[model samples]
Target: MGRGRQKAKATKQARDIKYYSPNTDYSALQRELKGPEGRATSHFANDPVEPDYSAYVDKYADDLQEDDGEVDTRRIG
Candidate 1:
């Protein structure tokens, strides 16, 4: 109900949290970290399939090129 009581409770909680050490399961962790036993071939095992971008190539192609079909790579302030 008072500041002193609240401070004491908060300090006790902080000490308890600071000293707490949770037990870890190393064998289960090793299996999970090791990944699948067999791999067909993939850089990313869980990568989502990508959609085809060929349909938009014609629409946005002009944005990437200048009037003479060259990218204006010169820096401008």
Candidate 2:
């Protein structure tokens, strides 16, 4: 309600946060980080699939080759 009360509440919250230390499950953390199979290979198991852009090159060959005279060679302010 008052400025002093609000300030005191904020200070108390800040102090609590500063000194806060909850129990950490290191085994669970290891499991999550290492991720199954007793190894970390689960993340690297699959290779990322790349999309083919070669089709677009053939379709827009003429458009890609044609350059408009509106090419700006000067530095833009």
Candidate 3:
């Protein structure tokens, strides 16, 4: 097909898909959203997410670190 015909066909197909609506089962959706009755709402209570990093932060604060602040870069050899 020519470029114009191919483009028109693609445009029509895209418009059909954009306006398409399929039958929705809302009750099934509600059940899926509710989930199982016995399942925990969150797994955080049983697991240690992040370990104590404050100690490491304080300990490493003494180490010599590079300057993160802005510096004048205008000087050129």
Cα-lDDT of candidate 3: 0.82
Q: Per-candidate TM vs. native?
A: 0.51, 0.47, 0.48
The whole-model C-alpha lDDT of candidate 1 against the native structure comes to 0.87
Worst 10 residues of 1 by lDDT: 63-72
TM-score of the candidate numbered 3?
0.48
Off by more than 4 A, model 3? 40-77
Clashes of 3: 0
Ranking by TM-score: 1, 3, 2
Clashes of each: 0, 0, 0
lDDT tens string, model 2, 1-77? 47999999999999999999999999999988765685645545477878999979888998767877678699989
Q: Write the per-residue lDDT of candidate 3 for residues 1-77, one digit (tens) a residue.
A: 47999899999999999999999999999999888889867555776677877868877875526556667689799
Residue pairs clashing in model 1 are none
Candidates ranked by lDDT, best first?
1, 2, 3
lDDT of each: 0.87, 0.83, 0.82
